[model samples]
Target chain A: MSTNDPYDFSARERDILRIVVGHIIPASAAYGLPGADDGAILADILRSAWREGRKLHEAAAEIDAASGGTFATIPTGEQATVLQRFREQHPGLARACEVVTARCYYRDDRVMRSIGMEVRPPFPLGFAVEPSELDLLEPVRQRGKIYRDAN
Target chain B: MVEVNEAVDVVIVGAGASAAAFAWSLAETGMRILCVEQGDWVKADSFPSVGRDWEERAATDFAISPNVRRRPEDYPVNDADSPIAVANFNGVGGGTMLYAAHFPRLHPSDFRVKTLDGVADDWPVDYATLEPFFALNDEKMGVSSLAGDPAYPPKPQVMPPIPMGRSGVTIGRAMNKLGWHWWPSDAAITTQTYAGRAPCINLGQCGSGCAQGAKASTDVTYWPEAMRERVEVRTHCRVSRVETDENNRATGVYYYDGDNIERFQPAEIVVMASNGVGTPRLLLNSASERFPNGLANSSGLVGKNLMLHPYAQVRGYFDEPMDGYRGPHICTWSMQFYETDPSRDFVRGYSYQFSRGHGPVTAAVNGMADGLIPWGEGHHEAFRSVFDHSAGMVSICEDLPEEINSVTLDPNLRDSNGIPAPKLTYRLSENTRRMLDHSVARGREILTAAGARHITSRSPLPYAGWHLMGTARMGTDPRRSVVNEWGRSHDVKNLFVIDGSVFVTSGGVNPTSTIQALALYFADQVKSRIYDLFD
Candidate 1:
């Protein structure tokens, strides 16, 4: 699917993207916003990701080239196998994932402002200033547990 | 030709929180009621998350009237076309469809703040009088909370408490340790399945509109029930005036249909549930020579004493990512330090509700360094860093009623119907200003106790229109208030104004629950033949 489209996602691309976002933000699980069967919003994100040239399948291709097996063809469980290696070994992939998720989740900067919040960088890393409180206990730091059972 | 509409026993205006409840209460009376809603109907399946495409605009109603420009005399604080500053939905449920559903009752002490604390005017009725109605509102709205907690009055709750995440627990623990009272909020959302609706899935998208049908929006609960009882909901109709006879008996109403065509419908009575802003605007425009000041304004108190629940936020970043952004919008209670205490410097109190973070787009706007320029990569990174790393508390402060703060007709501006819009002039009182400072200090202290790495706080910049209330106050005296204790216009018989506009005082909590309770009570009063007092 073309990224220029408002919300377009391929099935395979959506499945992997949904699980990744669910693992990254786990709150979506509490609202039942993201379940294994619910592929709607997840599909949109993946489509947007592809349009942005940060396609998960393509990124998986790079990971496959660096490691051995291709990421696109791997089974659900095996997909985790490939990502786990990079989360631990490839610092670049971990940073890239963080960057990608932040950009995707906070796409509506103007909407957020209407409600009295601004988006800024994480401080030192970037100087974008949105007024927000810092959270020390972010679940993403618990990276050892791949694919949290919930989201 | 104008669409001469069908007649009903009562013609109600607006479909937000107040209007929905009014329709729900009056529907069972077997009276032919017509509710003219300005918004359309929205169901759960039509929400953003459940749509066929992720960004199909997702059933959102953005109703910015293009043709109408607000005159300076009409909405001095806003653009000509944007006389009303509130972001309301153009749907069947109105703002109820989009609200976060935080249901908190104004404390008993809230009723007599003026007499008790010497702050503002006293409510014509006390909390004890309205307590039964409050319970009634809780039952119908499906409020979820453990009510036996001594902090609030004894009331029955339908849904159980929504589980607070680590952030709520941390704040709860920290606040309790400080000898403050905090409980799970009484939100009008189903914690478990009730009345054909599913339990809250905790998607934290309460603000965006609940797709799971868990939130107790009027459209899902009251409007449907009203529809079953045969309350006719007319969408896309904007009511402009309430026609009254020389005796001041409400006869009918005039409005514009979807096509901007003027239409008139007669009725036995008129109930203005058009909320704080809309109600006052209508009254200010319904001016005739017989009632030169305004409709039902014999005492000239129709659009005076306007108030809003001025609010601010205090942020706290803990050592761990509390993941505060993951659950319902407001899952925890507030510290009632100044709620009833007579020892406080301020006359009224303020309450706080804990909040989670927003999505990336929202977060970016929030991270837009409070006083910085609009753009840059540095801005983008700042937004990303705190993507999942923030949580805060919202402080809803009670605004003291001031005669100077008001909504009046703009002499020059006109709405789409060629009727004058309400021009508001408001400023925060010195006492409220001090209260904001005091609450910010208390918020910072609590965040510090919770071991926050960074804490930030904000206060309203003077007259920031937040919680609109008290424009047409209720009291026995026609000289001071507009409506009587029963919300019936003291000056005009058969003309009743429900909603936040009739508030004698703006309490330190959300007005939805209280307003719903008042609507139920007034409906019962009308049903019980007490309205004959005027006849």
Candidate 2:
């Protein structure tokens, strides 16, 4: 949140964003799945938004304004209501924020592991999927010669 | 301003899929072939698989549409008027650089759509004539397929088909339940190592340029062999216009080199392998005083009847994880609806390509956009539910060629070389809309049978103009078509166009394999009739 930080967000804006994204994708202790505000996800989101030229801070400010400038201080249920209104008013910004948060959060190792996915590049060590059973394709195969003949 | 003055036996414009095939076919003939490509050779190491940010790079740098990619080598296409945006690559491998390599053949019926369906014109040549070339191309490109496809003639030797992963198995089971014809895809990617290229590692990033050289892109499949046979491929050379003699025969081409220097390369025979859009753009740009309208516009059909297969996709999210990112992006497809039936509301039918959902980041963005994953409160739950639990199918529907859906020069927009940008005028026909609705309904049924919890469907993707065809159609009549059966220009005898531009009908399938086959067939024709090629 400092000037030297990669994101262009102020400390207050970052605090509001943390609260908003936490409400958006709250951590589930039962599933051990980390939320958008967990670990480096907020930093990752800020960096990704900065790289994509998305106005995350502006969206944060809009959410704060909608929540009467106390979005971070508000209760979780109240924050969700304010965020929903912000989403309704600014759909594009909502989509951008959602995309950035989801992209950064789901790609986090803990979230990926919690979802039973390997947190590595898909290549070099790809997952082993069972080969298809030819018997399952027999019905379509029996219908046979569906193409029109060439004259 | 340096002019490269040279003469070759055959000067081919564009070192794309067709050009690669043509050059490889003519390599044995010892013809002095020179192919000019606008983009540089995409090295294997440069593929996105080597990096962690492959998904983001694929969306930006290696995107199928030039409008989005904005690469320096790419030419600007003014597709503002068209519903389907023009998507292609300008490099040595062309669109193959980022294609899924789904190498489906045109059905025997595709050649005679007019004779069978009573719509669209019949191709000048039939499927039987091109079957041998198809076989040859398949062998050379290391096609991973299974024989006895029933959709094709008896092809004896197809490499083992790529394993259909979890998504394919689920989809195949669903298709069977729905009593639909689904087959392990005939892909250009290799299964076992063939022709010195490595076998596929199942990276699921075939659309982002294959780093492993597994996907038989021409750079790895054909260009290497062609270059070894002394086919001169001058990369980063963008051809501006075809120069013609007094008799309206193509003398050679004027092109701009890497340094933006003008050069003229003369040749005995000039072949334009620059796909459907680029071929017509070059022909129209080559207007001479003798043929004032355009190079081969005696019929004014050089840029008419443009056809882009109207495409649609449906994604199904299931209760169980499908392991959607584990295999080739496209390894299974259904052709049950490929043939037209009177019971259907539309005249033509469409084929369904089953995809093993996209990579993680792509799925995130697409899922979010389609509301499969919501924004607030439930975002984590929604994302988790759909992350690996999705299957998708894309419909490649037949688009009838209409004169109004054409490619013309934009009066204002030009490329880096100051050549007029090709403006595409296209709209989905009523037939196409009907076909899409029918296809999507069937797609939903297949997904439903597979126990999908929810489904998301797009009627037609606006950025799905992958198969550009029929801008310069082939026919016997000189007045109705720009090229003849063998891709020879009707007016310019020595000129040939061996690309999707000569497709009489945009078959309800991917067109790359057919484009290569036709190029091989045309190369054979030139070899047999070299003495009288000009006459």
Candidate 3:
């Protein structure tokens, strides 16, 4: 995390996002899916957050401002309420951040494998698809000669 | 620096689909052939599918839209006046480099639109005349499909069709439930390792230039064979304009080479296979003292009558995984609403091309656009609902030729090579709008029948103008068309256009198959008339 990004996305702001990520996509212990704020996933999110540059920083500022500047020091139990309110008020920005988060989240090999995706490029060794059921075309075949015979 | 390089018997411009086919066919006559291409060879291994961020690369580096991708070779198109943006690739394989390879032939009635429907002009050539070439192209390009569809006259598929995976069978059953017609779409993809290329291993994203060499882009299919026949394709040479003599003959072309130096290449005959937009752009740019308006533009219709088949997309999220992405974005399609009906709102109809859903990133992004996949607590569930659980179709609606829709030289914009850019002026006809609505409704019906819970649709899709055509039409009369029946330019006898630009009418199906068939047909005509080709 940059200590001096032009938009004030400093180390202090990074800590706030870590809290924000945990609340947004909390750990799904039942599914074994990590929270968005998990060390590795959060790193990817932060890198991608940098890609979305100022908007994310602005989102951070609004969340901080809305939380009476106590978003960082606030109890973990109360962060979700503040974040939820921020999301409801600024649905578009929150979603933009979520998309960026999800994009980075899904691209992780571990996350991809968890989703049953073969954590590799789809070339040289391609995926397997179920066999085609040409029998389904029986109905269409029965109704045959659908083209206009302009000839 | 601007001196003539060398003289060749025949010179072709743009090394795309038609150019490759035409060059291969004409090279049989023991004549020297040279092709000048604006871009270099795009190697199959360099395709994005070989990388982890393949989907992201597709959205950026290999984007189909030239204005968005803006690669070095791509020329900017001013499409501010048109609803649909121009999509093309500028490399050796041209648009085929990024094409989905859907490869469907135009229907027979598409030829005589005016005669059958009393709308649009009739093509001088009939489907029967080009059927043999179509079959021939299928063999050379290694098309794969099961041939028993009752949609049209019977034709044999070169190989077995790609498997109609989960999404296809799901949609097929839906169509069958409604007693609608659906069949495996004819794809220009090798399923049996034909012509030394490997068969597709179910590698999903064919758009990222099929690194497996399964997709039959001209670079893999025709260019190698054409090269073997000594048809030299000079890449990175952007032909600025065709030089015409005082006698109104196309003597040669002036081009910028790889070093960005200008040079003239002399030829006895010049053929233009530079697609709908590129061909018209070049023709209008080739305006000289003799032909003030444009060469081969005695009818003043060189860049007019632009026909971009308007496309409509509809998506349906299903309950189960639609299997892995297979075939050319689609393996099967419904022709339930193809061909015209006297009571219908439109004259020409559309093809229901059932499509497979996108990769993960694309699915997430599309879902977000629909506002179903929000960023909050339900993000993962919404993503899961869409990712592999969606099936869709696009209605390739036939757009009738209109003189008002045209491509003209942009007075302001120019390419890196300093050639003036092409400006597009187009509008969706009221007839087409009604047709789009009807098709979208049908798309909804089929998807809903297939047990789709959530559906989203858009008509006259803004970025689906991949099939550019009809700017320079073919007709018997010189005053009515830019090229004659055989694709010979009326004003300049030695000049010929063997691209989609010479399409008389935009057919409901994909035009690559027809484009290649026309190119081969034009080459055959040229070979037969080489002794007396020019007036």
Q: Taking the tens digit of each residue's C-alpha lDDT, what string does model 1 give over A1-151?
A: 2243424544544544555554443333222222212344344355445323444554444455543544455665665666656666754554444434534443334323432334432211211212222132132222222110110
lDDT of 3 by residue, B347-411 (tens): 77999888887777777667777887764467677677788888889999989888999999999
B216: Cα error in model 1, Å = 0.9
Candidate 3 regions with alpha-carbon error over 4 angstroms? A1-30, A34-102, B1-3, B324-327
Off by over 4 Å in 1: A1-151, B1-3, B51-87, B340-343, B371-385, B461-466, B530-533
What's the TM for model 2?
0.93
Model 2 per-residue lDDT at B203: 82
Candidate whose DockQ is highest: 2
> lDDT values of the candidates?
0.65, 0.85, 0.85
List the candidates' TM-scores in order: 0.74, 0.93, 0.92
Interface quality of candidate 3 as DockQ? 0.46
Candidate 2: count the clashes.
Answer: 0
Tens-digit lDDT track of model 2 for B180-259: 78899999988887889888888888888887788988999899899999999999889989999877778899999888
- Per-candidate DockQ values are 0.03, 0.48, 0.46
Candidate 1 structure quality by residue, lDDT tens digits, B1-535 = 6556667888888777777777788787789988886656765665654422222131122222211212111122342332224444546765566577888887777776666777677787777777888887777778888645555656787767776666676776677557566667888888778888887766565665777787888888888888899988888777778888877777888887777788888888789987677788888778787777887776677767877777778877655765534567676766455465557777667888887665554454345434221221243334345555667787888887878877777777666557776667777688878788888898898888877777877786332343578888888988888888888887678888888898988887888888888888888788887446466
Query: Highest lDDT: which candidate?
Result: 3
Q: Rate residue A83 of model 3 by lDDT.
A: 80
How accurate locally is residue B104 in candidate 3, as Cα lDDT from 0 to 100? 86
lDDT of 1 at B356: 66
